[model samples]
Target: MCEQHRTDSALERHGAERSGQPRSCKPAEARRAVERAVTERCRATHTHCDPEALGDALLVASELTTNAILHGGGVTDFRVEVVAAGVRVSVSDRSDRLPVARDPADLRRRQRVGGHGWPIVCRLARDVRVSELPTGGKCITAVVALD
Candidate 1:
């Protein structure tokens, strides 16, 4: 199986919060961790989230995590928080390369290998933001609607 499927399987067995430490080993692991956290938090808070929205949240998490790994120099520390309005997934990485959405036209012209992640994130996430970390690197955050 692929790394992402492996991580997802592991998350199925484990509870939401694994070690409370950021997972940087793989993008799939990071994405699964965020998804698990969001699922558990939604259950705990009794938030009304549809399956499609939850799937979108997971997709956004995966995209952001992949962006962080491929462009932001891997993951450092990350957190997923569930608020009243929605879920927030934040990933911190060692690089300060702020993510940007590639123009669709440019993508079609250049035929980039992997420039669609950020744009997918923009569509799936209700809000997206990035901030420089105090110690080092940067954090990319995405907020997904709860319901």
Candidate 2:
């Protein structure tokens, strides 16, 4: 795995390495890499973060990565940062189309096949932001609390 350590900084970013590659196009692979990275780091350092919160982080990662692959034209990069308050995840994709949050009630009434990921992320994350990349596409970042 592509490990990064920055003792001087609170926000330390790291990548998932596989076969000498840091990026993966597949959503499942991306999600797995993210979960693995965070879980391993927490376990190795014996962080006080709760297991349930970690599970929520994994769910958020899966939702974001799936959205990126299905609508964002594949994932370009994935990064997880260790912060003072919690873990931060940033996902980069090829599409410029930003995600729209649909009302849960509306979704239930309309019977849509899929439209819940963004809303779910919003509910679970602390500071969620989406930035437009100059070259094209957008980066979605969400911070999951340790509690």
lDDT of each: 0.69, 0.72
lDDT per residue for candidate 1 within 81-142, as digits (tens), equals 66655777777789977777766565347655568898888888888888999988998888
- What TM-score does structure 1 among the candidates reach? 0.73
Query: Against the correct fold, how does model 2 do in TM-score?
Result: 0.75
Q: After superposition, how far is residue 99 of candidate 1 from its true place, in Å?
A: 1.1
Give lDDT tens digits, candidate 2, residues 94-126.
Answer: 999889976655634766668889889999999
The CA lDDT at 145 in model 1 is 87
| Top candidate, metric TM-score | 2
Model 2 CA deviation exceeding 4 Å by range: 1-22, 103-108
Q: List the residue pairs that clash in candidate 2.
A: none
